[model samples]
Every structure is written in C-alpha cells, then in structure tokens.
Target chain A: MTIKGVLFDLDDTLYDSTTFVDRARKEAIKMMIDAGLNATEEEAYNILQRIIKQKGSNYGHHFDDLVKAIEGQYNPKIVTMGIITYHNVKFALLRPYPDTIKTLIELKKMRLKLGVVTDGITVKQWEKLIRLGIADFFDEVVTSEEYGLGKPNIEFYRYALKKMNLKGEEVVYVGDRMDNDIIPASKVGMHTIRILRGKYKDMKGKCKYEVKSLREVVDIVKKLIEEGV
Target chain B: MTIKGVLFDLDDTLYDSTTFVDRARKEAIKMMIDAGLNATEEEAYNILQRIIKQKGSNYGHHFDDLVKAIEGQYNPKIVTMGIITYHNVKFALLRPYPDTIKTLIELKKMRLKLGVVTDGITVKQWEKLIRLGIADFFDEVVTSEEYGLGKPNIEFYRYALKKMNLKGEEVVYVGDRMDNDIIPASKVGMHTIRILRGKYKDMKGKCKYEVKSLREVVDIVKKLIEEGV
Candidate 1:
C-alpha cells in the first residue's frame, strides 16, 4: 500500500538523545568529585549506571543515592553540586541530530503527513517539540499521557493512526525502539521502519526496514511508494 | 592603543546559556511529575529554584533535596527521573546563539588574536569550547584551573595577557560579568567590553563599551582601532 503519512518517535529517533545525555552525566560526575563526593569520576559513574539500572532512568535521584552510597550519609551539598553541574552541562549540550529538521522538511515537501507517536507526558513532550523548534513540522502529536497508554500498546499506535485520519496500512511508523514502537505498529498493520540510534545503533533488528538516520527514511518512503510495499 | 587581540569570557557572553538551561529544567520538572512526584509544575519549579539558590547550582543533588523537602524521604525514583529527564531536555536544548559562530569568524578574519579567559576547571571549560565548535578560533584559553586563580584575580588577566604577548592597552577584554571580567581586565589597562547576557542583560555598567551581542564587539574593535579609544 502507498504511504499517506509518516509517524515517528520523538527521543532517539529524531535526535541523538543518548550521546548528549551520556556526556552531560559524565561531566556532572566529574563535578561531583570536585564538590567532595568522595569518589573518582569512573567510580561515581559506575555507581550511577548501576542506580539507573536498578531504579530506572525515570527515577529522580541518582546523585542523591550516589552520594549516600559513597559517603555513607545523606549529603545535600554533594548531591546539589552534582545536580546543578549536571543541569548546566546537560541543557548546554541538548540538540537534535543535524539531519533531523532536514528530514522533516523533506517529508513535508512530499506532501506526506508527519506525526509524532511518543511515550512521554503530553505537555513535557510538547515542550521538547517546541524547544527543539520542530513542533510546526508535525501534523499530529500523540503522547502516552494524552492517550492514557504508552508505547508497546497496539491501540496507542492505532490512536495516532486514527488521529491522522489514515488507515494503518497507509502509514509508516518510525521509531528507535523495536519492542516499543516498531513491533506494536507492525502488528497494527502499519509499515515499520526502525531508525537505528543510540544503543540500537549496531543491533540487527528483525524488521525488514532499518535506517541509520532520519534522512534515510525519505528514500525508504520513496521506495515503499514506488514498490507499493 | 590599537586593538591587537580579543579575549572572551565563556558562557553567556558567547552563547544564550540561560534561556536553554531554564527551558531544560522546566521540562525536567514536568518529567518528574509524570514519574510520580508530588507538587504542581509551578510549585515544583519554585522549590527547585529555591534549592538552586540555597545550595548553589554546582551542588549536585537539587532534585534529591527537592524530594526530601516535599516528600520527607530520600526518594531515589523521583530524583533519578528528574535528573535523567532534566539531562535529556537540558542537552537537547543546548546550543550556541545563532550569531556566535559568525561573530567569531568575523573577528578571526580581522587577523585579531582571539583568546578565552574563563573561570572553572580547565578541562571542563575546554570541553565547552570544543563542543561549541569555537575551540579552534581561540589562540589561547586560560582557565582558573590552569592559572591557579579564578575571576576577580587581576593576575589571571595579566597571565592571559602575558601568554598573548600583547599589552593590555592593545587588547580588548569581552565578558558578561562586570565585576569579574570588565573591572579586573580594565584595571590591567585593557579596553573592556561588557557583553550583556542572561542576568547581566539590561544591567548598566561603568565601562565605556557595553554590548548585547558578540556581533557588536567587531564594530567596537574596528572603532577602537580607528579612534585609539
């Protein structure tokens, strides 16, 4: 079927989310040591990685836990230093991939509808869109908070399709996560292109279509349309 | 007294540091809420600012302190989520002002030796220079860590001058800070241009040259050469 719209994931799919955050965190850990956190940069970072693993990245207080683990007590001073430094460096480095906007523009020029199917708080995700200066490029944005569901939910993919007023077979879904974005949307009868990014950069996915950058999605769309895939 | 070099202060002077940071933090707070934190967006944000104030931005764990103050426990989930989300949004929004590169290019084309005199750890400051893609434009970058002296230390300014092999009268010091940068560099006989940015914006200074952007420094440099100001 010919594609009528291109649905996408926001974070790693649209940008180099992991690299910048990883750099910001590593920098913040260095600051924590300078501020008397009682651990080497490597030591602190390892601890942080463990904490993120156990509690999840969505958990709020990695540094606080890090200081207590290293210092054997709750120390606000060390924790605050780590966070503030983390903040300064993190926001200072945030930016989308160079080809992100160009890819969006290219998709729009083909008269294809562009929509975002992301798993985040509605307003927070919207803030990312606005701050990245890409909100105007999308014809639709469906977030987990608004849909009362999240990625991996087949109906959530369907919700985006419904919002775009296109059938699943006529839309192509692009995302970084195979389990979250690709699988569910594939099951929904939409074409799936897993855009390899961040941790998934080298992984061989089960999907028929995989791209290294958002820019490659353009060629895939053209092929899919010509071949009626 | 003709200008032979331009020395810069990093951060807001070379880029729009504050706005991106503020937006990143706000977006992070929204993520904190989605991760099951208490407090409205405004309330959480107000508390975050207060913690940043009391602990200073360099203190590593503002989010942890925030959770304890509001929830009365050292909760790691909310804090880690806050930090991660803060980090994601923060680095995603980090960028140099639109005119930063162009301004630096203009100064370089004039054959003026460009240098950076900034406070902070030497390597960290250098990382910023490298990431901003302006490190190559600078002939020298003297950080507080390298000089064993921080801002407001007149000797550090002198140190930069010594490295450049230019007399203070023949170089212009451009910084966002009146007290740390302009006053100290001016005392060493350099023509000082206060680049008003972030909190320094709109604040009147005693220096004869005040600029709202690095772009204006080019004109001032040309004017200083022609008039020997």
Candidate 2:
C-alpha cells in the first residue's frame, strides 16, 4: 500500500480542541459576569454550564438563554459580547499540538501529498490552519462548506482523493471520529487511521490503524511507505 | 429478574421524532419565507437545512443565522417567530405511535410499575407525556433537568431504581440510544432493551434485548415476568 497522500480532520486531530474550548468557555463566563450578567462569577459560570449541558455545545442560543435566565429578558448586545469574547479567547488560544507542525513538515519532506478533509465552515477551517502556521504544508484543503459535502459521505473523502490525483488505496485518512472519518474512508478503500482523542474517542469502529498523537502518525506513515502500501 | 418495573425513554421511543421534526422544519421554513425574508419557499427550506447541518439541530441561533443569511441582518423578532412557528407545528403534530398507549395499558395491567426516565428539560419532557395523554400511565417520571443527571450516567439509572424501590435487575429499561440508554442501564444491572429507531439505531453496543417498537416491549416484559428475571 504505497500511501501517496495523507488527509486529516482539523478540529481535534491537529489540535487539542477540547482543552481550547474548555479554557475559552471559562474565559467567556468571566467576561459575561463582568458585562452585567447580574450574577456572581461562580453563579454565572454554573448557569452557562447548565445551559450547555441542556442545549448542547453547538447550541447557538446559549448566550441568549444565559442572559434571559439571569436578567429575565433577551439582550442581543450581551449575547453578542459573550459570543465575541468566547470566539476571540478560543481563537487566541488555538494552537496545534507540539508535534503537529514537525510531523507535517517531516511528511512533506517525503514528497507525500498532504491535505485536510474537514467538516466545518470554510473560513473557520482555513483560519485554524493559518493560525497554526501549517496552511502551506497541505496541497489541498477541502471543507464541507466549500465542498458541498461532509464526513460520513464517501464523496467527501473522494473529493480529496480526486484532488490529490490518487486512488483511495494510495491515501490514508486520519481523524478522531469513527463514523465520520474511519468508516467512510475505509469504505472508499482508503486506509483509515483513528486518533484516540476527542468526543468520539469512545465510539466503536473498525480502522486500519490507530494512534495516540500526530507524532505516532509519522511512524505509521513511514511504516506504510517502507512496506510500499 | 421478576420485572417489577418498566422504564422508557421519551422522544423517538414513543413516537416518530424524525417525522415530527421534519414536518416542523418544513412548516418553520414556510413561516420564515412568509415573514418578509427574500427567498422562495425552496430557497428558505434549503437554507434552513444547510443551517441545521452546519450548526446542528440543537443550535440555538439557527433562525438568527438563516435570517442573517437571507436578509443580511439578524432580526430577533424574525428568529422568535421562526421558533414559535417551529415549536407550534411540532407540538401540534406530536402524537404517540399507534401501539404506544395500547402497549403501556397492557403493561400496566400486569401490575408492573411504569416510569419515564428521560433526558431533557423538565417542562418539555412533561409536555410530551401530557400531550401524548399518557402522563398518568407512569408511576414516576425522572428527567435529567429535575434529577440533575443525564443518560449513560449510572447515577441517572440508579435514581429511577431508587424511586421505584426496585433493584436494577427488577427493572426493564427501553430506549433508542445505545450509548445514552442501553449501555448505562445495563451497567446499572437493569434489563436493557434497545428500541431500534432514532439517530443512534446503528450504534454498536451490548444489550439484553432489542425491539422495533413500544409494542415489542410489552412482550419482553411479559417474558421477563414469566421467567422471574
């Protein structure tokens, strides 16, 4: 299996997304308290946490709910302030794992094609890559927003394979999700590598390879190359 | 395992939640189009679908995003109207599956205790039961909001067992989600039944029983009672 191209999931695969989100959430809570949320810091923080658990992490109205809960009315300005603070803190804190850049650089040295096949808004995905200073390492970046497809859809994987001008067997897809990354990639005959972290870590699925960190991916790629896989 | 109690998850377990949500979404899109947004019905529908996929079903600001995308500004009144229309349609369409009430009535005849162990806001969960006209069928109703716990947590399952005054083995727990319901109920020593509907139908997990509908649960409970489980 001569792996010609390597694709990755952006959020948790290249960076510690959970930690970043947690830290940013705490910061946002503090900002909310400071911005006349009418609650003690601890009270506001707990209120936000409760809202997150109830409405889920992706819930866009959490800030609105928080304001309404504490102040008995929806305040757009407060919600906007909270969202801005949250994203600003999150982006400011976003950094790739220490081995991420080095591993990508090493893989690039092998003349292997690298790409990112991630499910996210185009601008946000690109921003993360640029912020991490690894945008130049990849030959292609396919985001769901731009590609008109998302993970678990084999077309999403095929798009990257097509762009790299490589067959599925000639590519390796690495991500933290089983259903979204490993299963779909494997179905397309691409080698799938499961990174054991993030929300989907406990999700059960079959894959060709598993690794704990990006550093370990370099070793797997080297082994694959040596075996002509 | 003398099945003295039967616990159920609400939502898809009792009714076709997917169908309800789909209908409600279509109605909401219609409402959005009629409320001065500049788009055709089809365009509005697609926008809502895209927003749902991008931000997730639980996203609190989907209407805000939809209005901003189509109208170039966020109008709180429009978002509120969208939400009101969506929920109104959903609740109006909320009806239990045909077999749901009959199955519960039959199960109740056997002198076994009935309870609802659900994860959602207290008012919402109760509203579903009340709307289904099955509120009195349960001897107990334990929701995550009031109980301070959610599914897959052993504590959440244990709370139901305690309330029923029965050991885990004496209870038969049925739900749609393998990770959130079956696994945790099994962990707590309850007889687990996976109702095969909902987003998690394909999730892999170990359970003592699997069924297609609430009607099948009555049969399982009867068998358990006969076998003195």
Best by lDDT: 1
lDDT of 2 at B90: 88
Q: Which ten residues in a row have the lowest lDDT in candidate 2 chain A?
A: A75-84
Best by TM-score: 1
lDDT of 1 by residue, A1-229 (tens): 5889999898888877788779989988887787677888888889999999999765778987998899998654456567667766766776778999999999999999999998875555665676576877888888887789988999898899999999998998888887888889999999999887888666655888887878889998998899986
Which CAPRI quality tier does the interface of model 1 achieve? incorrect
Candidate 2 TM-score for chain A: 0.87
Q: How many backbone clashes does candidate 2 have?
A: 9
TM-score of the candidate numbered 2? 0.48
Regions of candidate 1 where Cα sits further than 4 Å from its true position: A227-229, B1-229
Evaluated with DockQ, which candidate comes out highest? 1
lDDT of each: 0.82, 0.81
Which DockQ values do the candidates obtain, in the order shown?
Answer: 0.02, 0.01
Those runs of model 2 whose alpha carbons end farther than 4 Å from true positions after fitting are A1-229, B39-61
